[model samples]
Target: MGDTRWLSAEEMRAWNAFLAASALLNRQLEQQLKDDSGLSHPQYEILVRLSAAPDGELRMTELANGLINSKSGLTYQVTQLEKAGLVRRRTCPTDVRGVYAVLTDAGRRRLEEAAPGHVAAVRAHLIDVLTPEQITAVADGLGEVTARLRALGR
Candidate 1:
């Protein structure tokens, strides 16, 4: 291994704060989603992604990639959604080996019902706490990190 470079006190403080905030935010969001919509945060995210896709559908591989989930995990989530009548699997017309997760009418309705409460929770926990400038700074800083990670093929 190469020589380890330690973080400075300031850097460590910021890093820890980021970690704690991330964990707490996710926990809160998950709890809120579960309580309000009987859905987990990951499930909500899956629905959100499908809702935004063209024709409210995405190939299983594409959905898994976008969600950063393992194939099996994505399949399981899709199965759960399917059981709930929120989504259905369709065979890809152009690719016999591929499957698509298509959001059902019920899925769209569920998402619509969940969105308001989710947005309110987000605003209450994060957005309402930050000034406009701070929000922009946070977005820009995270966008930079995301770009760097993607560049590294992470």
Candidate 2:
């Protein structure tokens, strides 16, 4: 190797901050969701996605992609939801190989119950702690990073 470039001190600080914030936020939100509605974070997200879809459903592949989760992981979560009467999986008529995850009425009600606590936790832990400029900076910076990573097909 001819040369190597490592993160600068400032860059290291930024990276560490990001890692810590994301991990802590995820943990807190997960706990809130579990305690408030007996739903895991991923399950709640699945319900939210389906509830917003045209027919309260989406193909399994599409749901996995949108969630940035592994197909197997999504499958397990969907299965759990199905058993709980919160969701159902149906084969697509036009495409036998495709499966759709549909939110049940119970799922929607669970989401409505979970959302308030989740949003409040998010606000208390992150949003309300930031100034308007910091909020904008975070949104723009993270959005750009997410877009770039997605563009790379990762």
Candidate 3:
């Protein structure tokens, strides 16, 4: 306890900026996604991930890990998507305990419909606001932060 050192002014400023920006950005994107396609941010991400996967399918555990989400959370979201006819879950034939999330045709269509507006929202909120140098700096800096945290089992 005695050896604990608090953040300096600059460090505090950086940390605060990161926290606020990330939160606001997530909020903005969530709203944009919801408005554009009646999809939540996490749902949209699941669709995007599955769309890019081979055969538009991935294991439930893989999906959960890829999204940094809990298995149960992913299950709930997958179930929502399933109800919407946007996704389906399949039992892995070789492993009774394994399940897969498969993107449906409707999911791909919805993603295609949603992509342009989502891209524009992203540009309007973040990318277009930054210079190339700032973008690179952000990418490199956050990339390192993500790598370190992930390495720590985040």
What range of 10 consecutive residues in model 2 has the weakest lDDT sum? 1-10
Task: For candidate 3, list the clashing residue pairs, or say none.
Answer: none
Q: For residues 25-102, could you state the per-residue lDDT of candidate 2 as single tens digits?
A: 999999989999999999989999999998899999999999999999999999999999999999999998999999
RMSD of candidates 1 onward, in order? 1.4, 1.0, 0.9
Clashes of each: 0, 0, 0
Q: Measured by TM-score, how close is model 3 to the native structure?
A: 0.97
* Per-residue lDDT of 15 in model 1: 97
Estimated TM-score for each candidate: 0.94, 0.97, 0.97
Question: Which ten residues in a row are the worst by lDDT in model 1?
Answer: 145-154
Instruction: Write the residue-wise lDDT of candidate 1 on 1-154 in tens digits.
Output: 3788889999999899899999999999999999999998989999999999999999999999899888999999899999999999999888899999999999999999999999999999999999999999999999999889878975
lDDT of 3 by residue, 113-150 (tens): 99898999899999999999999999999999889989
**lDDT over C-alpha atoms for residue 17 of model 1:** 88
- Cα lDDT over the full model 3: 0.96
Q: Model 2 has how many clashing residue pairs? A: 0
| Candidate achieving higher TM-score, 1 or 2 | 2
